[model samples]
Target: MLWWGKEMNEWQVLHASDLDFLLENSSSPYDYSGDNNESEYCCGTPPCSQDFTFDRTFLPVLYSLLFILGLLGNGAVAAVLLSQKAALSSTDTFLLHLAVADMLLVLTLPLWAVDAAVQWVFGSGLCKVAGALFNINFYAGALLLACISFDRYLSIVHATQLYRRRPQARVTLTCVTVWGLCLLFALPDFIFLAANHDERLSATHCQYSIQQVGHTARALQLVAGFLLPLLVMAYCYARILAVLLLSRGQRRLRAIRVVVVVVVAFTICWTPYHLVVLVDTLMNMGALARNCSQENHVDVAKSITSGLGYMHCCLNPLLYAFVGVKFRERMWQLLIRLGCPEQREHVRQLSRRDSSWSETTEASYSGL
Candidate 1:
């Protein structure tokens, strides 16, 4: 991974002509090559050069916006989940954890934007800590999503008296297990991240390079970070969908729709990012065959891929706003509470009455 920039130039020696041909045949309106060598041997060019000025200078501005929005949105979700008077069900528990994880992840955006603007100014220790925290949340979010899918499946397709007997204990245990696994997976990131100076660019970067462990570490990270979690999520959702189809209840259908929206939103937001990372990792490991003269083509590709990943930070809030109706309602209630105390009190009274009615109905059913 560390040698991606250097390796691209080497590959260009073997694949320059093919790359030139590709550029010529591309359907894009812009010129693919201006005044650069097309061979893989060339180390620098327009979009590929480390010094390539991003015309999108607004990226940092955009990141700052996302950072603010994500923090507020996820924090609200966490607050609503935490503040609810109802017993903490498995779904609520998982959503709370997911919000916490995403909030932590978004909090690091400003640091990254600063790094991108003026190079990595933070010391080695901070770098490692930041990287570890980011990975911890990343994995935690994935695990929680999978857990949510499985929980939905159980609540619907495999609904049974025993499953609901000790719901609180099960939810607590599952959350603990998720956190433990996230910490374990994040340990390497903590160890490997460090401050490094790029001589060519004259910039300092916070990065993870497993030069000592070589390809093995890269492979492990790819599997753990992308492939394994993806598979687990896919499997759980598939089973959840099957169970939902088999079940016959209005509540089951509503729950299924919520789970489906959550899963679909997650997939849409994360799939491109993971696919790009997987491809870039493969390329870094020399697993991808490339025919290009200039190393810049691959570099440009990487930059674009990274930008795509950064977009995921912003998409999470949209998912919550769109898929999580209860969260949205709570946010509106919070706004009302802040803006009009009398109205808020009236709303609270109505909410208490509704809860009392629900409990009365449950008590009557139990008595029967």
Candidate 2:
């Protein structure tokens, strides 16, 4: 889901021939008062004529790949999770919700993929729906990751079962609150996004369509979607690492490795996109000088980095679910119950081999 920046206010007043290049192709603020064929003046300087050939050819393929892989991975997670509803831990519950969020996020990809390759064939109403859906799930997924980190911190660092009593009620309440907050965050997308014809580009784009600085929405997303969750995960994982360091066991060592990988993978995937967003935010807020070259660079960087961010949905299942011994065992057991006799013996062997270490891992992170 692309976000609005301060320049949106100026874009609303632009003539059809002077409007930015295809807004649908960009994930950052659209460059206002520019034509694809000729440079136009904006911010007291001439804007660059951006060639979207790369975006048209590249983004669709990338989004399609992410959609297919994310669907299979997150779908397997959801299916396996639902089958074991009776034996879910707090961590399992969070994983289930995270999978749900990733699935929802990927479902919006086909529309966006189409938009990048072609244009907004879907009407303005569906545009708003797709944008809002993307915004909601994106924010919810990040927040749920933070919740998982906090739950891990409690389990490993504090060794407290805060949700042991009425766990379902507590977990449900927490997830519902996350969804509510995400819905609130998505309001601007529902309100400002629409399918509009860019005369210079000669295409209809589902993009932010208003004249407001819109810094509040950007700041909210930056903080709630990225910064706050990043801080929570960093602190929680750092504390958990400290506690694990004092212990001596193969399980502790394995848990430490998993924690390190999870944190590193997340940072690698998301930090670039948020950093680009932060730079764009500064540009929008006038804290940094804006130029045609810098704006073009930011837009290109946003596209590339945002693709990196989207891949995290595909990685979440591998990092958070498949990495856990208990989750794998449960999945194998579920397969055995579903008439997969081949997996029955495999499950037995796995259970026997992992019994001691798996229990400690579960006690430490509660089924990851």
What local distance difference test score does each model get? 0.59, 0.76
Q: Candidate 1 residues 130-204, lDDT tens each?
A: 777877887787778777666554544455422376877877888898899888877776777677665546666
Q: TM per model? A: 0.73, 0.86
- Taking all chains together, the TM-score of candidate 1 against the true structure is 0.73
The TM-score measured for candidate 2 stands at 0.86
- Name the regions of candidate 2 deviating beyond 4 angstroms: 1-13, 16-44, 211-214, 253-260, 320-322
Superposed model 1: Cα runs more than 4 Å off: 1-49, 55-59, 160-166, 212-218, 246-251, 291-298, 304-307, 336-368
Best by TM-score: 2
Model 2 worst lDDT window (10 residues): 1-10
Which has the greatest lDDT? 2
In the range 1-368, model 2's lDDT, one tens digit per residue, is 23332123243335554444444334434533355655333355543455567668777889899999999999988888888757788877887898999999999988988887788889989988998899899899889888988888887788787789999999999999999999989999888888877654677778777644256666777889988998999998888877777775658767545545666777789889878878977876678997768877887787788899899889977875556676688778888888898888888898898877776776766564
